[model samples]
Target chain A: MQRNSKLSEMAEVKLLGVLPSPYVYRVIWALKLKGIPYEFVKENLSNKSPLLLKCNPVHKKIPVLVHGEKSVCESMIIVEYINEVWPQNPLLPNDLHERAVTRFWSKFADDKGSSVLKIFRTREDEMEQVKKEILEMLQAIEDHGLGDKKFFGGDQIGIADIAFGSVIHWLTVMEEGILGAKLLEAHKFPRLYSWLKNFQQAPVIKENLPDFEEAVAFYKGLREASLGRAASK
Target chain B: MQRNSKLSEMAEVKLLGVLPSPYVYRVIWALKLKGIPYEFVKENLSNKSPLLLKCNPVHKKIPVLVHGEKSVCESMIIVEYINEVWPQNPLLPNDLHERAVTRFWSKFADDKGSSVLKIFRTREDEMEQVKKEILEMLQAIEDHGLGDKKFFGGDQIGIADIAFGSVIHWLTVMEEGILGAKLLEAHKFPRLYSWLKNFQQAPVIKENLPDFEEAVAFYKGLREASLGRAASK
Candidate 1:
């Protein structure tokens, strides 16, 4: 009886999410890195499941990790929670200063990285402004964040790397696949360009990334819908 | 020689900030709670200091904590760094799940709680909209955040309390001191009202709160200047 109970407890980890979402992908990569086995429950965003609503009552958003009776919300918070629960393949550094620096970059990614997606959803008239904003963000990362290090922390892809993986990956889809723009010029942001290459090629990240064609189609639809709604308005 | 070296190393903590700034106070309260001693370096917002610019080149913002040769930016991140370094007061819970929950609230406070400040700085035309946003934020806290607990972590004041400390305090300043309004009526937010009373009465925070009249005058002048510029435009 005790053994059965223990098994049930061990198997209770579940993730509530929709695929092709950068926020959800952050949690997925963190869990994969930790090698903690879990179930993935797909959520229909248009009609949110009762479980998702119950799990994340405040935000009512995806990437909610349900562990046993408790549910953790927010992508970066879930990533940190996973790192805390499973110590293997550590996402943050051991040194105090290095950990602080890692967190600073993580916070930066959470704050500014999402703005890049505006280009995917905004009109062509606003594309230049959004592109300029994304370029400045990439330049900051190039100049101050990822100097010569293969990843933000060092050789290993850690929290900061996962935080940015979704941004750069989706930016590629939006800029190259849909918009056919060249905002992330290698010459302008050589370090960022290299960092994205290394990040995408990282083992867990490479395998788990959304299919390129699928992601392009998904965001292209979203852009059309957004522009269509705006035109009518 | 070893004793002298240790003492000097211990005394190397320093804080860069401006007075009455909630972000800066969050770090101050955290450090005070941990009983960590540090020097406070005031920065002129009009003329940014070299040390402030040097310490936080990315944001060029205040509430930068300089420890030995390392500097940590962002208020809540600095607070977390302080908690990690000094585990005496225990800003975060020991349980992995509880810590995750605490972090969730901390992130929420960082993300949404700051919107309350918009009421203080916004023009009259936008006042109602900002007020509505703040009321919704407070309602979320009332409904989901604080129940009957003395604090977010129960009994002890933790990271989330410090995160919202500046927002609530400044809201009180803006509403009561300047606007002569009563947004945070006790009946509307019974738990939050009790929490604020308990929070303000807490040891480290009570002693460190900025003088009420001074904060009022400072923010009022800034608001007038903001409105003046908007009118001219």
Candidate 2:
């Protein structure tokens, strides 16, 4: 973590998160995009810390961004806060209509993107339904969300792009590294497929994204451990 | 529906919604608060119109705010857009932290507030679980969301207040008119109960709110019709 000696005392940012969390990575990408320096506090999900419990009593969830005196929970909310606090690299567009559109897609991603993660835990009978749902989500993005633009906010990577990046990255991890599925085929969802490539290669995101193989291993270990417990019981 | 002859040509706001929808009311309250005139276009959700399909192809859900050439979908997003477009009665606070906190609760309402409605559709075996979920949601808000403030956004009723207003109102209608359940007991959740009164009696909200008896009838009719279909099937 880089410390700004001049302004370190005022806005000391600390992120409480587990490394493999797609939600946590959303905040990390936003903070890195704005060139903000923060301490990365690793949290154990199985044994949550007192600080995490104290700060986010309601949800007791990860990716709690504590800035100076106040703490903000929830990933996208934290991203929006970081954007507002440090308006250097604007996460949202300038035009008000564009901003509203940006928020629409961001909200869409938050609402629907998590279903792709269910692929990891799904039984054989339910995989098809989950896959169909995810494909429909991709179709929505391909048809209406991205319109021949470089990013969701266009030209510059914005909030919506970051919001989808985590989902796409994990989707890729599950597809290529674990399940070897072809849900996000270029032929079917060309625009979304291209958008994923663009999002992955974006400067800050490219550098900071967790290793694909590592995420695959992490998820695989989790599945096996859960299965082992089930067998033992 | 009020029309501003002067600004009608430029903005031309049209709300596509059903009157009984709690989500639709959220957008209506925000628009009325800002004193923005809009044409209310009633939608029969049973047979969705081509206009609704064209405007919101993705979700095809209601509370679509069509402003001239642009259309914004999703209720809370529409509310936020209204606040941004017409900055008259500000929906969000000036302070950044307060704004983020407000968004947090608003998201919480969007995520959790719907469980109370599940009571209407819930079977006898599932009623206890659904009731428990709603109670937990109410307790969270009572404990952390409202801290003796007149509104969630402070003295003024803002975005968070509007976000919760719909949920709280629907919960009351179900409890008082339909279920007769003692879920929101004043002794249990005193702050939230008072906040509901404050929210319901607020200037624009008081006048614009749908009739409680009518809403009860609508929901009851809906439940009976669905049950009839289930029984026949």
Candidate 3:
């Protein structure tokens, strides 16, 4: 896609990220939803760019969004920044209570949602514990995080949806490919199951996800390498 | 302070928390700074109040804020809710990029600041790692976070300050009283040391801090009980 000169005029927006990262996709989806034009730089995980290091010195992780000269690191923080900067199609709800609730879930995504990533690095006994935590995480969101709301922040695709959407989808892809078991089963989580349907079908998110097979293969290779390192240790 | 029904009409604000809790203090400082009136319900951490469990069923932790009928959990989140609900005295900076920067440091408090708490729980050998992390956390803020600016967000006291403040003070109280060491020395962290002085001198913060000697004694007793429990286990 050609750069929209009009959009770029406000500020130079750039994203530093690696492929097959739901965190990176969170930023991509938020930008696309808000209709903000940004250049995407694919970062090599092994050899991080000097710009990435300078932008996010504390964590040294991404996706870091450089808006003009200021850079915002962490996935959801970048989403919130995008929402605030480009307030056209509001990603967070307007109501103060709803905004706080959206942020609560967004924080939940970071605190609890990252537990699923342990599958990549855990031993057999630890993977069982990780899987249990994942189930409890899914159950909590299913029971308390969603109702018949269609999306987490109600009818609109809000920030919380963007936060958890990446986790739910990619978790499923990894579970299906590696474990050969359904972590997000319909019977286990009917509410979350339906939420998954409504969330992905949204035009913005639907178009932005990495290809299913490619992502699975990528995660498989990454997981094998991770476990292999664990074994060597 | 007595509850004013008139103030409650605008929003019936109630805080659920136990005394001597730094997490609880973050919300208290923000509310007091904003000059919002509210009733405080002291919770028993050993046996939590039903209201505490109900408002924050997910985390089941204290420092949950109830405004009218709505509730917000997580200390920083509650501070944010207080900022939004009562925007008279803003805790966050107004500039879009500055707000992102404020949130980045606030998140850093949770991600990095909590490592300092290990002194309360860990054995002597573990203290080295904990102190190393705390030093790095302080250095990150000194070397990169603060500059000639008085506060993390600039001249005025901001959200990031409040977030990091609770962690620093609590760690100091526990460290000084329990460990018998000064974790935040002026010679080591000149910028942060000046920040602590400026932060504590601010009327709202100065007035709200727990009685220092009393708090130290309380932490000393708690530490002995905690460490004794660990020994038995």
Best DockQ among the predictions, by candidate number: 1
Kindly list the per-residue Cα lDDT of model 3 for residues B58-158, writing each as its tens digit: 88998899887778899998888888777787888887778888999999998898886667777787788888888899999988888888999888888
Candidate 2 residue spans exceeding 4 A from truth? A1-10, A230-233, B1-10
Off by over 4 Å in 3: A1-9, B1-9
Instruction: Give the TM-score (vs. native) of candidate 1.
Output: 0.95
Candidate 2 iRMSD in angstroms: 2.6
lDDT of prediction 2: 0.88
Candidate 1 CA-lDDT value = 0.87
lDDT by residue (A47-116, candidate 2, tens digit) is: 9999999999999999999988788999999999999889898999987778888999999999999897
Candidate 1 DockQ, CA atoms: 0.63
**Estimated TM-score for each candidate:** 0.95, 0.95, 0.95
Better of 1 and 2 by DockQ: 1
Lowest summed lDDT window (length 10), candidate 3 chain B: B1-10
**Model 2 / residue A66 / CA error / Å:** 0.5
Which order, best to worst by DockQ?
1, 2, 3
Q: Which ten residues in a row have the lowest lDDT in candidate 2 chain A?
A: A1-10
Question: How many residue pairs clash (N, CA or C atoms closer than 3 angstroms) in each of the candidate models, in the order given?
Answer: 0, 0, 0
Each prediction's Cα lDDT score? 0.87, 0.88, 0.86
lDDT of 3 at A109: 87
DockQ of each: 0.63, 0.60, 0.59
Indicate the residue-level lDDT of B92 in model 3: 88
